[model samples]
Target: MSEKILELKNISKSFSNLIANDGVDFDLKKGEVHALLGENGAGKTTLMNILYGIYKPDAGEIFLEGKKIDISSPRDAIENGIGMIQQHFSLVPSFSVVQNVALGLKELGIIPDLSKVRKRIVELSNRYKINVDPGAKIWQLSAGEQQRVEIIKLLYVKSKIMILDEPTAILTPQEAKGLFETIREMTANGASVIFISHKLKEVLEISDRVTVLRHGKVIGTVETKGSNENDLARMMVGRDVVLKIDKKPSHPSKPILKIENLHVIGDKGIEAVKGVSLEVKGGEILGIAGVEGNGQRELGEAIYGLRNYTGNIFINGSKVRSGDVLERIKNHVAYIPQDRKADALCGGLPVYKNLFIKAFSSPVFSFNPYLFYPEKLRKPAEKLVKEFSISTSSVDQEVKFLSGGNMQKVVLAREIESEPKLIIAVHPTRGLDVGAEEFVYNVLLAQKERGTAILLIAGDLYEIFNLSDRVGVLYEGQIIGYSEPDESHIEEIGLMMAGVKNEDKI
Candidate 1:
């Protein structure tokens, strides 16, 4: 057995009334990747935060190299060769990669010469096959490139113990492959890794062992080679989960959503979407496939009246004007945005209030035309909570306090209850567990069977192929190709995603 590089004994942490971690014991050996697998709010992040010194455990002991050690702050952890890359990258948007890495280096002195920093970054990047340009500004990098920068930052700091939180959530399949290769190289170089991910396949692929957490305690730790996806999922959710969606064939009807010559500008003042035309019929899903930032956001926002666009959007054969969100809502067009907290829900409000967002003024929930009959909403909210299997102490609990999966469920329940004619779902299952994903898929398909048109803009090709009846490849702000979803079209779609147009105007 390899030497135990890190160990935690009887770790307990709590926030307010919530028990974040309960007498948790975990260990990691030298040159091995240890994964923490759990549903959101299952205490995986809490344990990692304790190890990273972001939070002090209420009761615990941490040992490094067979000697007890104190990690009181991030500074202490860094000095002790521990580092973490959070889901959100910590680099300054205005700073260069080299400058961000040189922020805390003691060797560089007060003025801090960056030439030495750049050289070391290059050396580490090449050694680990984790590619990044030292001179590039943080805002200019893609999500994958930005993640590589985070890894290089840890390498530059000489961190022997690395903690990565949901590392591949924003990456493409190719980028994830590169990251797995980098993890292998890191282990080969004798570094120990603590990987936290919702994806079970990734846990099995990158880690030597996985420790499952539920509620706030360790369920069990098992060797990766002996376990499968179902085993890990059961350990995480305490049940046998359906890992695949059983999709049914679509029966098309009249167009529920139609876009004509759409040209929408992005936040950067560029024409992100250009001359895009498409239609999604009742009982059909038109999936738009592309690498992130290929105008997917702009197109979705324009149709939902959240962005300025010189285009014509029609729902149920009626024209939807620009900046008329309420009008579109009246027309029964529902939008499931990419960022739930940012665009979809009011975080500070309770789950019940968020659920009543669209129906707040309806006669059933309103009295005297301007005020809500609070009692009228209680039963329906409780019913929605139960039907969605939302894990919450109460419907009166703040929506922000819910887990990611539960939060998404709240959003789904509210939108589906509105009974829209058309639905625009954007990255609906981005950071959910296998169990949560299965539920979302079933809900969307159920809506489809009811003849609701859907526009699915997603980064995962597998997701797109599974739910979509027709697929459109979006490249450089254009629909380069449109085809029926099938395994044989993957190669052509792959080419189109890279901005290559077929000669037949595909």
Candidate 2:
């Protein structure tokens, strides 16, 4: 085994009443890819934050190269040959990759030399097989390209220890494979990596070793050679987890959602959804599979009437006007947006309020039509909290304080209980564990059985195949192909997801 390059001893952290990390110990060997696996609120992110100097450990010691080190800030960590690539890119959309790479360099003097920066960026990118146009604007690049730029920025700083958080969350299968190859190249060149992700398959493929955490404590660490998904899932969840969901065949009814020649303009003022047409029938799930930045968000927003678009959108055979959010809601359209924290819930408010938002203006819950009624919502809110199995002290607790899984349950319970005719769920199970993922699957399937039309846009193909009756591959803002989710179509669907166009099946 290689020498230990980094070590954390008895690490502990807490946020309010939550014990994020409890007396944890972790180490990374030289030139090794060490994967950290855990459930939501299981302290994976918190532990990485401590290593990257984003958070101070309540109790612990960090040792680097056999010597204790103090990492009080990100600057200190960077100075000590450590760098982190966060799940969300922190690059400026208007600036080029070269500019973003050299944004905060004390060594670059008063003015950074643009040519030198660009040359280094290209050289590092090429060396690690992280292809990117340094001069291209961040907004103009795809999600995968932007991720490569982030890696290049870290490599340019000569970082010896790298931390990647949910690195392939937005990447396609091909992109993820390429990323694993890049990690191999980086580690082969003597860089140690702390890989944190929820994707178990990729973790097994990339990491030299795996560590599972549960309930803010280290469950166990094992070699990747003999490890399997079932084992890791069991460790993380403390029991045997049913990875596969039991979904019955769909019995299609009349089309609940129909899009005709829809063209949506993205946030950047470009036509994102170009002449797209599809139908999601009642009692069926139409999964839209795509790599991120391929009109998925824009199409979803358009379908929910949150964004303006050209063409016809019909909900329950009634035309929903473009950009009419309330009209779509009145038409019984429930939207579980991609970013739940930012879009779905009010973090400052309690759980019940988040659930009560949809019926705020409805006459069923409102007496004076414009009056605030907290008491009238408590019973329903408590009922949902219990039904959804959401772990919280009370429904009055702040929504932000709950774990990611519980928060998603709040979103699901609210959307499902409203009994919408159509539900648009985008990446609904983004960072959940296998246990939580199973729960989400069961909820969606129950809704399907209840005859609610669902349009699911997700990056995980496994999820697409598990619940979707029919799958549509969206590449570069168009539906390239459609297929029934099966072993025979996996390869073809994967190809279409990577922009290889084929004939539409449905």
Candidate 3:
């Protein structure tokens, strides 16, 4: 057997009355890519936190290369040669990549020489085959580019073992492939990597071994090559997982959502969505397929009244010409934003409070003017959290303490429980692992079966094909093609997303 780089034995953690991690054991071998798999609240984040010295384990023994080490803080973790790249990066948006990477390290009262850091960063990028521009401002870079900066930060710290938390969540397919290749290079150079992902395909492709977690316990660990997705799904969920979204033949009902001659400007005030007209019925999932930044974000924002646009929008046959975002929501339209942490969640608040944000004006939480039951309100909120399988110590736990998948579950649970006439999900399963993805698919299918209209804007072609009843391909501000979900081919969708049109149309 290969040498063990890190090991956790009998590791457990709790908050007040909630057990986040219950007696878990994990091991990583040198130069190995070990994957940690779980549903939301399955204790993955807690375990990583313990390893990274963000949280002290209540009871456990940690051995780094056969020597017990006391990791009291993040500084200690870094000194011990362990680094973690968080799912939501900690980069300063206005700062250049080099500035962001050297931010905290410079304040250690050392020589603040940025040129040296930039040189090291370039060398690290070259060594790992991870390309990044050190001079680029964080905000101007693509999501994939930002991820490269995060990886470089870890590498610059001289980390022997690196943990990547859902590294491919925001990447394009090509970008994801590039990231996997980088991971391979890192491991090939004799570094240990612990990857956290919900995408089963990516995990299977990149991991040497996979560990499955469910309800704060280890279900099992298996060699990636020996087991398939079905086996992992069964272990993670404790049963046979449904792998397909059941949908009936889509027929046009009365149009619940209509956009006529819509045009919207991008974040940089350039034309993004141009003259796009589409109709979504009350009982169908209309999928918008595209590469990222192909106007999908602007289009969803425009429909939800989050952006200024030149167009007409009608919901339930009523004109929403001048409606605001709140009005659109009140009119039985729920939206799940692409970036959950930025758009869907308030990290400072407790889980119940975040849930309250969903139905704040509803009668259940508010009786009338000036009278509200704080404790009584938690009943419904708790029920929703439990039903959705959101992992938290309690409904009162801070949302920041939850993992990415749990945070997403909170957003989905709130929106879906709202029972909206239309649900707009943008990249709904972006950071979720296989078990959580399965749950998300089931939730959407359940809503569709109940005749709720769904507008799914996703970059994942497979997800769009699997869940959508009808699919539309978006290019540079245009709907380039439309077809029934089953009849459409992924290559055709890819072409349209690349702004390629048929020669006949030209």
Candidate 4:
């Protein structure tokens, strides 16, 4: 057996009434890639945060190489050869890669040598097959390139223990494969990694050992060689989670939402969505599958009436005016945006307020536009809280206090309850766990049964295949291919997503 590089004994943490971790024990062997698997709210992030010094363990001791050490802050962890790369990149968008890396270097004086820093960055990039340009600004780089910059920062600090939190969540399949190669290179050079991910297939493929967590407790640790996806899923979720969605075939009706020759300019003044024409019929799901940043966001926003575009949008056979969000909403259009924080909910507001934000002007909860009947609002709010299973002490609690899963539930409950004819759901289950994901799928399916036309814009291929009646491949702002979600068409769809044009398929 290899030497144990790190260990946690009797680790426990709590936030008020909620226990995030409970008497957990975890160990990492030298030069080993250890995967920490869990569902959302399973304390995976909390445990890793404790190790990274972002949070202190309420009751625990950490050991490094058989010696107990106290890590009070990230600086202390870094000095002790530990570093964490978070899911959201922390690089300055306006700064170059070299500048971002050099920002916190104590040895780099006020007048630091830029050339030397660039040389070191290039060397590390080439060493790990991380093809990042040191001179390029962070905003100009792709998501995968930004991730490479994060890895380079840890290596530059001489960190022996690396913690990656959901590193592949935003990456394409090809980019994820490259990240696996980079992890192999790191472990080959005698660095241990604590890879925190919900992706089971990647965990089984990349990890030497796997540790499962359920409801803030360590279920068990097992060798990856003997563990399978079904085993891991059961342990993480404490049930036989149906990995595939169960849904009846969608029945087609008249077109509920129609877009013809849609052209929208991105924030950078470039045409992101170019002459795209598609129709989503009532009682059916039209899934748009593509790599992130392939104009999916633009397409969603254009349909929601949030972006200026030259297009003919018809809702229930009536033309929708350009950039009129209220009119679109009145036409029974509900949008579940990708970023829940920025686009959907008001974080500071109470849960009940967010629940009825779309329907505040309605007579059911309002006596007048200036005054709201509290008792009337409470009845509906309480019903939604119970219906969606939003775990909160009171409906008056701030939305930000809830966990990620509950926050998503609030959004789903709100949009689905609106009884919309057209629901534009973008990355609906992007950061949710298997259980919450299942809940979301059930809700969407229920809406489908109610004859709601859904345009599911997502990057997850599994979601596209499982839920979509007809799948369309969006590449470089155009619908490159369209096909039914049959198993035989998987290979052709994958090719179209990579911008490959198959004449026979398209």
TM-score of predicted structure 3: 0.93
Q: In model 4, what are the clashing residue pairs, if there are any?
A: none
Report the poorest 10 consecutive residues by lDDT, candidate 2. Answer: 497-506
Candidate 2 per-residue C-alpha lDDT over 1-506 given as tens digits, one digit per residue, 9 for 90 to 100: 47999999999998766788999999999999999998876888788889889999999999999999999999999999999988767999999888999898778988789899988887888889887898899998877889998888889888999999888876877789989989999999999999988888889899999988887899998999998999999988888988888779999999999999999999888889998999999999999988778899999999998899999999998888999998987888899998788789999999989998988768765567657778889898999988877767688889987766678788988987898889999998876778878888998998899999999999888898889999998988899888888667887887897787675433
Off-target runs (Cα >4 Å) in candidate 1 are 359-379, 502-506
User: For candidate 1, lDDT tens digit of each residue in 1-506?
Assistant: 38999999999998777787999999999999999988767888778888889899999999999999999998899999999998767889899999999987788888998998999999999999988899999988888999999899898888999999888888877899999999999889889999988888788889999999898899999999989999999999899998767789999899999999999998778899999999999999888999888999888899999997897888999888987788888888888888788899999999898998887555564556555666777789999998877777787889987766678888888988789899998888887877778778888999999999999999888788879999999988999988777678888788888887777445
lDDT of each: 0.88, 0.88, 0.85, 0.88
C-alpha RMSD for every candidate = 2.6, 2.7, 2.5, 2.2
- Candidate 4 residue lDDT tens string, 1-506: 39999999999998777788999999999999999988766788888889989899999999999999999899999999999998667999999999999989889899999888899988888888887889899988877889999999999988999999889877888899999999999998889999977778889999999999877899999999988988898988888988888779888899999999999998778999999999999999999999888899989998999998997999999999888888887898999987787789999999998998988656654566767666677789999999876767678888986766678788988998998999999988876777777778888888888899999998888888878889999999999989777678878888998898778544
Give lDDT: candidate 4, residue 24: 98
Reference-based TM-score of each model: 0.92, 0.92, 0.93, 0.94
Query: How far off is residue 263 in model 4, in Å?
Result: 0.5
Model 3: colliding residue pairs: 198-432, 198-433
Listed per model in order, the count of residue pairs whose N, CA or C atoms clash below 3 Å is: 2, 0, 2, 0
lDDT of 3 by residue, 109-173 (tens): 56678898889888989888888999999998888999999889888877899998878888999
